[model samples]
Target chain A: MVIKVENLTKRYGDLIALDNFNLEVNHGEIFGLLGPNGSGKTTAINCILSLLKYDKGTVKIYNKPMAPDAYDIKEKIGLVMQNVAVFEELTVYENVDYFCGLYIKNKKLRLKLVEEAIDFVGISYYKDFYPKMLSGGLLRRLNIACGIAHQPKLIIFDEPTVAVDPQSRINILEGIQKLNKAGATIIYTSHYMEEVEQICTRIGIMDKGRIIAIGTKEELKDMISSGEKITVELFSMDNKILEDIKGLPHIVSAEYRDNSLIVRSSKGKNNLVSVLDYLKSNDIDFGRIYSEPPTLNDVFLEITGKELRD
Target chain B: MFLHNYIYRLKCIIRDKEFLFWTLLFPIILATLFNFAFSNITEAEKFTRLNIAVVDNEEFRQNTALQRAIKAAANSSGDKDQEGLFNIRYTSKEEGDKLLEDREIEGYIYLDNGIKLVVKESGLSQSIIKGFMDHFMQLSSTLETIIRKDPQSMERGILDKAEAAINYLKEVAPSKSSPDIVVNYFYNLIAMACMYGGFWGLKEVTVIQANLSSQGARINIAPIHKFKIFIVCVLAAVTVQLFEILLLLAYLALVLKISFGNQIGYIIFTCIVGTITGVTFGAFVASVVKKGEGVKIGILIGSSMTMSFLAGMMYDKMKYIISTKVPVIGYLNPANLITDCFYSLYYYGINTRFFINIGVLCVFIVFFSLCTYLILRRQKYASL
Candidate 1:
């Protein structure tokens, strides 16, 4: 294991943020910590980084105790927190250079790395612009560049894609995969289930400050009883028809909204056909339908019970 | 790591241009304005007369010596000789009283049994005139006795002096009475101006902390220690502040012809220390308070004003109140210390406890600095 967080616990006065949380991230794997809002994702990360004073925990990075002044250990780990941490005064290139300078002392080498980091984020045109002048996405890219420019062995990106446009989000995901390919152990956290499914090799889903389940995407799908979600767009969804569909044998649950009904069921068998037959018998006009296999959303819903957002 | 942090901090300061202007430039401009406004004479100008009023209720009118003194006052060459500087006018007792009440003259001298100076207040020019007249009375009395003793010509000596002066005034061009105190203010004036504001802690409170354009958030992270960052910033800020001090001082020296002192190194050192003290106090303030740009400004204005007030920078209208009631604040205020230090250096060739002043201010700087560093080190991104 490259990173070991053992029996981690933290509290704020009377409120408990994390409780006996244990996690291990091995080298050469994109590990994901998925959680809802206020589910101690940030708390755990902070404790691991020794940014917060955890009441009880032993965070071993590269198999040694972690403390703030442990510059040798801190040297190999990079953190891009949820908040953008670039200096508002510095231009894009300068921001990257400054942070990289913390680890890399050689000026010529640091300059090359800084330039590559800027270009890698597709923000070369904004290399001279100050952080205040850049748009939100551009600033986010700058934040990532600052964190990853030092080129640490282990990189932790906490919700790096939040509030970014789709194009930027795609670019960020691609960059993360590239960073992993370059032999960086990545710890990625996000509530976006599809993003986790798309990139994370193994995901740990947490709730109420505990990891309820951890496995590959397919393995997590196997863990959850609900295998697939069928969403039907309906022209007219009658109250009795919706009730009758819910009463159907293999149907798990049905929700009607925006002229659509979402039917979820365990047993990946074709329940959509049976539901469509019932809808036809009931003379309900429906639009297109989409059947997505059990995503991380299904895995999250199964373990947490409540929706991840609540 | 040090170089990285340094570059990053430099960048931050550069990006925040509005902050730079307010913190660095604003206080300087305000100080310059105060310097010029409070100055009695920023430049040399044409000579003017000292207005004096006389109300003599004596039955001693035919005193030729007194008449001669009065007439010759207009034509006397200089105040040092007690004959040339007064604009004398005689009025009735009631008229003098009314004129005093109406502020028509600075004061009036009444010569009865003894001389009495009647005015709203005693000022510098008034005291100088009072001394001159006292001497003139005795000199006239002396000259009168000498002439009386000769038994040759029955002439009062003052009458002869006055007649001769009046006759000379008709033939010769006038001369100015330049007082020694007025002409001798070139001593350590530069060091005093530069050393006071910074030593007083007004610049820090007013400029760096109060300028809202400089954000505190950008610095809390960035993988660098706060103290090193602080050192860089303080060094940078003081360098600018001391340069401004030097600029104003040079303008005064080269242009206004003001001199600080003979000991050039010590004078400049005093200014440098004062600048550092100001920058340190500013950093300390920034550490303690959040949302303090306005409060910092308030302190800046209030501090410079109060320091100037206590240091006798303006009219000494509140000297009685400041000296007696609030002796501690008035006597020990840094600007008072700085100004007095320079004054002592110039007058007595003494440097009073420069080490002590620096040590005391360093205590404040360290105490506040440690607190600020602890607070910054424990910074939080969220409200918690």
Candidate 2:
């Protein structure tokens, strides 16, 4: 295991930030901790990094206990915070060089690593620019370059794409994948289910300081009974038709609004076919029809009874 | 590693324009304004010999002792180096009256049973003349009493002895340098500049504590020990602060022509110590306050300004007031101690007082550093 947080618990006065939180990230998997804004994702990351004091339990990295003074363990870990953390006084190249120097002592090797990190983030053109002179997207890229310049064995990105523009967000996600391919284990945290679904090999859905579910995206989708959602555009639909569609086999719920009949069904291979057959049998006039596999949001909603973004 | 961190830290501090403006340019500008405001008063304070007349009556002529004293005073006026107390003109009583009334002389001295001084009004020059006459009369009276009690005592060279005693009683300055009261303001300005170094110290602490800033968090996550980074950052702060102080000192001495005495080595030493104290004080404040960086900075600035004010940066007499009335505060305040170091150097040369001030400043540095360490040693924060 690259990171093993067992029964970790932390409290801020009466509020529990992490309650018996347990997570084990393997050597080469992109483990995503998915949660909403205040779901204790950051608190758990801080605890795991030994940047914060936990009320109970332990965090181990690379089979060694984590601590504030654990230099050996810390040497192999890189952290890109949710907020941009580069020095405003330093230029892009200088900022990267300063942070990289912390880990790599050799002047020649540090220089090369800083240049590569800046290029990796696609910010080499703005190397001479100070952080304040850069746009928001470029500043975030500079922050990433500073964090990843030393090329540690494991990297933790805590909501790195928050408030980022779409283009930069895609660029950052792709960079993480490249780092993973380069053999660094990654721990990515975010509330954006699409982001986790897009890159994360395995994800833990967190709510109220606890992981409600943890599995691969496909496995998580399978945990929920709700499966494919079928929608059919109709000129008009009576309540009788909607109730009859709801009574179909494997159909969990059905509703008609805005001249469309939307039906949610339990996991079944022929659910979409059954919904279409019922629509034709009722002689319902339909224009367009489509079906979507269950999303992470649906799995979250089914398990937690709340939206992922809540 | 230390050198690498120190170099980058130095670069960051040097590029902080707002901090540089306050720590470097502000003192220079205030010194220039002070020079403009004090130049005229300093010039007016230069002493000029007072003019007085002696009535050429038989009483004045018969008094050979008074004649010799008057001749000596007149002779001393001819010398360029030593200042003369009086300019005497011998005239008839009628001419003496005319000179006094016409304002040609400040006062007329006539030997009536003893020396009597007449002046138009009471002022510094008039008071000086009266004081001189009173001393002469008192010495003459004492000599007469001694002669009447022991007539043969004169053969023992009593007159020469009295003259030697009078010469011994003449006022002597405490130091070779001129004690310009206005120079205290410059000392206070330098003290304020030293305290401004707290800003650099504050910045160092702000950027190193994970709970304080995101940059701090990033630094905390690094493999190196946090204290190592802190030491490097403090070295950078001290280096920049010392350079700024030396630059301010040079501006005051060379550009503004303000003399802080001839003790160049001691002045630099004081600046070095003051810079360290300023930075350490800032770090102490940053560590103790559980607030945002803005609040910590505000407190540092407010505390520094208050210390400067109490040390007489705003009013010269305030330093004396604090020193005499609240002596503990005078000894405890770092600004006051730094100011006194320069003040003692200017007025007393390198004496025990100067060493005492320097010692107190060193103590302040140790105290601040210890407090900061006590507060920051936890390493891991309960919250960020």
Candidate 3:
């Protein structure tokens, strides 16, 4: 494992920020800690990074205990904090170079890596601009550049796209995927399920300082009692046909409203095909149809009994 | 790693116009204002002549030696518009008394059986007039002794010695010039400027504490020893602050023409120690106080200003009063220590007092720095 956290517990006064939070990220994978705000995602990351004091448990990186003085382990880990943490006084190039110089002592190689990191984040054109002079998206990019300039083996991104524009968010997600492909194990955290679903190799859904579920997208979706949702556009739907669809195997619920017939399946391989065959057999005229397997949001909603963003 | 941190820290501080304004421009502006405000007072003390009246009485007419001495004292030295020792107005006793009472003349000479100096009140002019009278009395008494002991040897050199004693007394009177009070303002200003280094120190603290800033959080997770970063950043802060103070000193000495005596090495030592103490104190405050950045900054500024106020930055006499009233606080206050260091340098030669001030500052630097290190050495924070 690149990063392993076991039974981590942290408290702030009377409130427990992280309760027995456990996480493990393997090498060459983007492990996503998906949660809403205040779900202890950042707390867990902070504890693992040795930036916070935990009341219980231990954090290990590369099979060694993590500590403030774990320079050898820390050298292989890059952290992009939840907040923009670049020096406002430094230009983009200087900020990246300064942070990169922290790990890579060789001046020539640090310069090369700094340039590459800036280019990777697509912020080379704004290299001369200070953080304050850049737009929020560009600033976020610079923040990422500074963190990853040294090209550490394990990169932890804590909600790096929180306030970024949509385009920048896409670029950031792609950059993270690129980093993973380039052999850096990634630990990504965000409240946005779609981003995690798009890039994360395995997902851990957390709520109230505990991981509710952890698996690949397919495995997580299977864990829930909901599967592909089939929506068919219908000019008219009979109540008898809706009843018949509900009686079909694995059809959790079937409803007809506003010229559309919707069918939700609990678990089945061909729920959509069965619904379509039934529709045709009954000679129901449909305009359009859509079958979407359960989304990470759906899995999160089913497991948590609340909206992912709520 | 140390070089990188120091260079980046230097860049961050130098590019911050706000820091430059407080550390550099503000002191220079205050020094200029002090120069203008105290110009007249300092010049008057240094060069202005006193006004006096002499009574026209039998004692004065018969005292030929006294009359000749007064005439010589009244003659101008022919320097650019500078007046003599006294602007004398010979008048009757009633007129002279009226002049003294009306405050037109500082004092007057009352020639009677024996000469009596008359003044309504005591001040620099009154003191100078009294000094002259005392000098004349001593000379006349000595002459009387010489004449009584050996009347023939009196012409050998007694008169010449009396003249020399009279000239010597002339330099001791109003012309002697009191210590310049305006330099106290400049001294206090340098003290305030050095304490302003606390801002840089506070910035260093906030930047290294993960709970205080995102930059701090980012730094804490870096693969470097926390103490190394702390030392490097603090050195950078001191370097920037010391440079700013040196510039302020240059502005005072070169541009404003303020004198700080000739002890250049000691003055530099005092400034360096003061800067380090200010910054170290700031780091200590930042470490101990778990408040937000704004509150920490407010505390630093409030404490620095309060200390500067007590050090007599606004009213020079307050420093003396505090020293006499609450002497412990006077020594404890870094601003007071810095001001006193400059004060000792300006007034006295390099002596025990100056070294004592410098030693106290070094103690402060070490004590507060150790406290800061003790508080900050552990990198793990309760929260972030």
Candidate 4:
């Protein structure tokens, strides 16, 4: 395992921030911590990074206990915080060079790494620009460059693309994938489920300061009763037709609303074809139809009630 | 790594306009204002020879003791060319009245019963003439009592003591150079400038504490030792502040024609210690105050200005009052120590008092810096 956090518990006053949170991220994989805004995703990351005090637990990185003074571990770790943390007074190049110099003391090596980081983030054009002068997207890019300039083996990105533009978000996600491909273990966290579903090799869903579920995207979806969501555009639909469609094999729910039929099915093969055949046999006319496999959002909603969002 | 941190911190501080304005431009501007406000006041206080007119009468000519006292007060320098406490003009009574009316003589003395003094205006010169007459009368009375009590001992020590009394009044001559009152403003200016170094110190502390800023959290996550980071940043800040102080000193000495005496080494040493104390004080405040950076900055400015005020930056006589009334505060205040360092060097020469001031400032620097180190040595924060 690249990073292992076992039985972590942290409390803030009367509120429990992390309740026995356990996670194990393997080498050369993108592990995403998915949750809502106050679901202890950041609290868990902070505990693992040893940035916050935990009541009970152990965080081990590279098979060694993590600590504040563990230079051997810290030197090989890169952290891109949720907020932009680059210096406002220093230019992009200088900011990158300064953070890089923390790990790489040699001036020449630091200069090279800084240049590479700026180039990797595609912010080479704004190397001389101060952070205040850059737009939000460019500033976030600079923040990433400052964090990753040293080319650490274990990188943690806490919501790297929270409010980024689409193009910049794509660049950041692609850069993260490229870094993992370059032999780094990445730990990603975000409340946006699609981003995690797109990049994460293994995922953990957290709520109320605990990881409620952890598995691959397919496994997480399978853990819930939702299989596929099929929606059809209809010209006309009767109430008896909808009840008959609900009676089909593996049909968990079927409803007709706004001149359309929506069918939610359980785990089964050819559920969409069975539903279409039942609709045709009833002489029900349908327009365009869409069949979407169960998403991470469905799994989250099924496992934790939607009321958990604050 | 230390050198790298130092260099980058220096670059950042140099680029910071707020630091530049506070530590450099503000002092220069304040000094300029002080210079303008104190111009006429200082000119008026310069030492000038006092003019006096004495009536030429039989009583004045016959009384040798009175003649000697008047001569001692007038020709204090014992030289005809140099000016003294009084420029005496012996003239008729009518002419003396005319001279007093014309403001040619500040006052006139007439020997009527014992001695009488007249003046058109009551001022320092008139007061000096009255003081001279009083001393002569007292000496004459003492001599009479000594002769009456023991005529034999009158020749032993009474005449010598009376002669010493006449010599004491003659010591107030134009021998020593007049003290410059305006230099106190610049001395306190340097003190205030040194205290401004705390702002940079506060910035350094806020940049390293995880609870303070996001940049602080980012830095805390780095592999470097926290103490090493603190040391390098403090050194860098002190260096930058010292440079700012040097620029202010140069502006005062060269541009404003303010004199800091000829003791170049002591002046530079005072600034070095003053800057260190300032930065260290700022760091101490940053560590102790659990509030935001804005609150820490407010405390630093408020306390520094208060100390500067007590050191007489606002009014010159306040320092003297504080030194006499609240001597403990005078010794404890860093601004007072700094102002006294320059004051002692210029007026009293390099002596034990100057060294004591330097020593006290060193103690303050070490005390504050040690408190900051104890608070910052921890690598992990309780809450980020």
Candidate 5:
């Protein structure tokens, strides 16, 4: 395991930021912590990195205890914070070089690594520009380059794509994947479920400072009773038809509104086909149909009885 | 690693226009303005002969002793190179009154029961005339007592001894430099500049503490020890601040033609100590205050300016007043100590007082540095 956190507890005055938080990230696994705002994702990360003092628990990296002064363990960890963290007075190249120099003492090797990190982030064209001269996306890229220039064994990215444009978000996600492919264990945190779902091999759903669920995407989805959701557009639909759809096999709920029939089913195959067959036997003509597989949102809603974003 | 951190820190500080403006350019501008405002006042302070009209009447002619004393003062025979203290125009009593009224002379001296000095107003020149007359009266009274007690004492050269005593009190240069009171303003200006070095120190501290900034958070996770980074950044801040102080010093001494004395080595040493004190003081404030960067900066500026003001940055006499009335503040205030270091160097030329100021500054530096270390030694924050 690259990171092992057990029974971690932290409090700020009266509020518990983290309670019995336990986590284990394996080598070469991209672990994602998915939560809403103020869900203790940042607090857990800070505690794991030994940047924050916790009330109780232990954090270990590579099977050794982690601490503020654990340079050996810290040497293998890279952190890209939620906020952009680069010197405004320094150019992109110098910012990267300075941070890279902190870990890699060899000047020649440091120079090579800094350049490679800048290129990896695809900001080579703006390397000579100061941070203030760059746009938000470019600045975030520089922030990432500064964190990962030394190429540590484990890289932690905390909401790296917040407020970024769609194109830059795609680029950043792809870059993170590439970094993971190069054999680095990654810990990613975000409130955006889509982001966590798209790139995370395994996801941990966090709420109120505790991990509510943790598993692969498929496993997490299987843990919930809700499955695929099918929506059919119709010219008109009555309450009788909605009731009939609800009575169908594997159908958990059915509702008709705004000239569309929406049906949610339990975990089962051919749920969509069954809904269509019912509609056809009833001689109801549908204009359009959409069948979406159970998403992380559905899994969170089924488990928590609330929206993932809420 | 040290060199890399140090070099980058230096670059960041040097490129910071706000720090450079306050620590370097602002002092130069204020010094220039001080020079322009005080140039005439300094020139006017040069000693000029006081004009007086002595009543040439029966009492003055009969009192030959007073006559000879006044004549000696009017002539520059006491010191060959020095100018006479008084310019006497012998006239009748009525004419003397006219000269005083017309403001052609500072005052007029006439012997009634004794020598009496009359002036239009109280001023330096009028006060000098009064002082001279009073001294002569006291001397005459002393001589009369000596003769009455033992007339042979006069033949023993007591009169000549008294004359020699009077000459001993003549104005003399304390050192090989102009005792221009305006120079204190420049010293205070330099002290204020030194205090402004706290900005760089504050920046260094804010950048290193995880609770203060995102950059700080990023650095706390780095592989290197926190103290290593702090020391490196502080060294860089000191380097940049020292350079700025030297530049300001050069502008004041070489360009503004202000005399900070000829003790070049000691002056630079004081600058170094003062720069360290400023930076360390800033770091101490930043560490102790659990506030945002803006609030910390506000506190630093307010405290530094207050210290500078107490040290006579705004009012020249305030330093003297504080030192005399509130000696503890003079001893404790780094700005006051730094200013006094320069003042002592210029006037006393590396005396005990100069060393005392330097020593006090060293104490301040140690105290601030220790406090900052104590506060920052905690590697992990309770919150960020």
Candidate 6:
């Protein structure tokens, strides 16, 4: 295992942030920790990195227990916190070199790594510019460059694409995938479920200081009663017709709003044909219809009631 | 590996504007004020009064000899600015008691015979007048002897004596000479403003308060050892402070004539010590405040100025008072020891106390630096 956390429990006076949290990340796996805001995602990452003290738990990296004084393991681990971290005074290249130098002592090697980090983040043009002089997207890219310039085996990224433009977000996601391909174990955390669905191989949804569910995107989709979401745009919608439509078998939910009807179904077994037949038998008119499997958000809302579980 | 980080720390400090303002500029401005301008006397110039009556029943009261003497008797440096020194009351003995009881005056002087100065013995000004009167009496007795001995001049009247004194003054004129004043500094032999460096060295002090000093909190998590990090921070401070001292001393010596005699190297050495002292103090300040408190102005003011004062920066008498009341304060006062050591080299010669100043200054640097290390050591990164 690249990173293993067991029975991790952390308390701050009267508040318990992490309760018996456990996970084992294999090498080169993109492990995603998905949660709502304040669900102890950052807290868990902090404890595993020894940036916080845990009352009861064992955080091991490379089979060794992690502690604040574990410089050897810390040297090989890169943490890009939820908040962007880099020296404002230094240029992009200098910032990368400084952090990278902490691990790679060789001057020539550090210089090459720093250049690669800048190029990898698509911030090559801003290599000599200070962080303050850069735009938000460029600054975020620089933050990543500084963290990953060390090229550690285990790299943790906490909401790296936050406040970024679409282009920058795509670049960051691609860069993360490339890093994973290059044999780096990535521990990714984000509130954006779509992004997790796009990149994460295995997802872990946490709520109220506990892991509510953990699995692949498809596995998580199967766990919920809502199998798929079907949106149909009709010329007109009726109240009794929507109720009549909701009464159909395997039709988990139905709603009519803005001249459109939305139907939710569980265990997709030809519910679309059944729904079409029911609509035609009722002589209900519709223009167009579209269908998609349940997204990660639906799985998240199903497992952990979305009533502010944080 | 650490050197790269250390250099980065240096760059961070140099680029920090607020840190630069507090650590360097603040102290230099205060130092300039202390050195170039200061008020020595205050509160003592506020005044009370002196009441007295002059009388001579002797027939010579109208004599020119006594009249000339009376004018001369009132002659004093302060008396030259008329309406000052005394409020003369020409009254008889009968009014003396009434004036005293009515609180018209604190004392009464009945100048009968030679001169009898009477007082209520309740006020402080009485002693001042008494002292002045006693001194006047001795001079008058001497004058009488001179007059009696020169029987020929006595016939020519008191103006003749006055002329004679003026003639004597003209014959023996006070002369001016450029004395060789060699200066020897005790602590900072180089006359460096190293103490000024502490102001800038404490720039990282802002980091402790809030990460607002910078958007990123990378230094807190950087891989360098805490002590080594602190040392690097101080080195950056020293770089700035040393640059300042070099400029200051060079200007003071080449342009302003703050002579260091032949001990220029010694002055520089001591200045380096002062810089170390300043940087160490800066670290301590950084440890406590997380931002410079305008270069420890309250301490720099209280310590430096008082040191300058006790070391004759203000007045020599103040040195006596400080040495009497607080010896440690005097010894620890860098300016006091420095000026005294230099003054010894300038006016007298190098003494054992000079080395003592240098040694104590070194001790201050060591102690302050250790304090800075201990403080920086306590800062742990618990993701806090």
- On lDDT, the leading prediction is 5
Model 6 stretches with alpha carbons more than 4 Å out? A307-310, B26-201, B204-224, B255-263, B288-383
Error of 5 at A253 (Å): 2.7
User: B123-187 in candidate 6: lDDT tens per residue?
Assistant: 46777777766755675677688778886666777645543344233333122212321222222
lDDT by residue for model 4 (B84-142), tens? 57788999899999998898988888877768898887777778777877877787898
Q: Report per-prediction Cα RMSD to one decimal.
A: 7.5, 4.2, 4.9, 5.1, 4.0, 8.6
TM-score for each prediction? 0.76, 0.88, 0.85, 0.85, 0.88, 0.73
Q: What is the lDDT of residue A63 in candidate 1?
A: 95
Candidate 1: stretches off by over 4 Å: A234-244, A277-287, B1-4, B39-67, B78-83, B86-234, B248-259, B288-343, B346-350, B353-355, B366-384
Please give the ranking of all candidate structures by TM-score, highest first, separated by commas.
5, 2, 3, 4, 1, 6
> Candidate 5, after superposition: displacement of residue B147 in Å?
14
Best prediction by DockQ: 5
Model 6, A32-119: lDDT tens digits are 9998888888888877776566788888999998765667887778777667677677888877887788778888888899889889
What is the C-alpha lDDT profile of model 5 across A56-167, one tens digit per residue? 9999999999888899988899999999999989999999998888899999999999999999999999988999999888888998999999999999999999999888
* Candidate no. 4 TM-score: 0.85
The per-residue C-alpha lDDT of model 1 at residue A287 equals: 84
Please report how far candidate 1 places residue A95 from its true position, in Å. Answer: 1.4
What overall lDDT goes with each candidate model? 0.68, 0.89, 0.88, 0.88, 0.90, 0.68
Cα deviation of B311, candidate 2, in Å: 2.1
The alpha-carbon lDDT assigned to residue B376 of candidate 4 equals: 85
Off by over 4 Å in 4: A234-249, A254-261, A274-286, A307-310, B46-178
**Docking quality tier of model 3:** medium
* lDDT by residue (tens digit), candidate 5, B41-152: 9567568898899998898999987888888888886565678888889999899889888999999988888778888899888888888988898999989999999999
Q: Tens digit of lDDT per residue, candidate 3, span A1-310?
A: 8878889999998898888988888889999999989999999998898888899998999999999988999899899987999888999999999888889889999999999999999998999998889999998999999899999999999999988999999999999999999999999999999899999999999999999999998899888889889989999866788889999999999888888888899977889889989989988788899998889888988988898989
> Residue-wise lDDT of candidate 2 within B97-195, one digit each (tens)?
899899999999887786787788889889988887777788889999999999887999887677654434666788778878888889889998999
State the displacement of the C-alpha of residue A203, model 5, in Å, after optimal TM-score superposition.
1.1
DockQ (Cα-based) for each candidate: 0.39, 0.69, 0.70, 0.56, 0.74, 0.27
